[model samples]
Target: MSDEVIPETTGLRYFDEWLIKKFLFSHIEKRIAEQSIKKYGASPIYLSERSQSISSLSEICKRRGILTGLGDLDFLQNCSLTQQHGARSGFVVLGQTFDKNLGEALQHHAQLIESGSIQFGSPDTEQQIAKFVEGIISPFKDESSRLKVCEDQALDFLSTAWDLCRSLIRQAPGYEPKN
Candidate 1:
């Protein structure tokens, strides 16, 4: 137990990010202690591999009996985790980077839906994301209730757009011609 200090803003290594996604059970202190384990790297991973073990990356995401996607699971598992778990999992401030929030959240939700394409996999992974993210951030219900919250939002936007289109058709000057 060296009295050394590890900062929180540091990005997670590859292996730590993977365990948190696959197991969804890693605590920051847990990884540090596991590093000391002799004879093996990490469970399902050996400590010798350190954080970024490409060989140890799982091709699938197994969560609560659900599996997602078949290709390399590296970026999805390793990148967004620190974003999801953040400082509690480590002094990890950034894991993966995206251009914006709504897009990033939507992309995550989409991938989740993609993952559920297999049998016994969840079909409403997107429905769970809002409550899932909110659970960590605010006073939304502790669990997700239904799927239409997302659908309703999309419908609302479309409805508004349709109304605007109709109004413009009636209001625009009809005699104008383009050269």
Candidate 2:
């Protein structure tokens, strides 16, 4: 289902922009690293086999499950993982190209992502994000309570980040935007 195409809407358009920005940042980072190595005659950095295997470019995301499904397991003599465990066993990798506050919030949820406890569009995910915003906005407030984040403020934050990232990418030395 990852290959399935979803039509663009207001929400999806934003999603697409976010994804493209992530890919662009990674591409530019790699290019810059390569240039630095060439200019300084420094040794190239090598990635581990596992890290190299997980290429973001290879993962085509669609409107599908946040976790990957386990393939046929009838061949196993004794399977220890139950259906529930199998359902949430997959991991979704996220790239960091935004503010530290966002990165810290994501870091807090990294465990949940790895554990398959949080799904896309889940209330838990929203709650986490809200909590993160609350922490930044109202550090003195009680952590036990949930703070309602203004929708407009959230959207504005994202828009500003998107604009800033685009501006920085354009200013990147020798960076050329594709036609």
Considering every candidate listed, which one attains the maximal lDDT?
1
The lowest-lDDT stretch of 10 consecutive residues in candidate 2 is 69-78
Clashing pairs in 2: none
Error of 2 at 128 (Å): 26
Q: Give a tens-digit lDDT track for model 1, residues 112-152.
A: 11121222347766667755655556532321332355467
Local accuracy of candidate 2 as per-residue lDDT tens digits, 42-132 = 6355433222212222333357623221111111101212221234433222334344433332333233111213355875898777666
Candidate 1 total steric clashes: 8
Clashing pairs counted in every model: 8, 0
Report the C-alpha displacement of residue 81, candidate 2, in angstroms.
Answer: 27
Name model 2 segments beyond 4 Å from true.
Answer: 1-16, 42-144, 147-179
lDDT scores of the candidates, listed in order: 0.41, 0.40
lDDT of 2: 0.40
Q: After TM-score superposition, what is the CA distance of residue 80 in candidate 1 from its true location, in Å?
A: 7.2
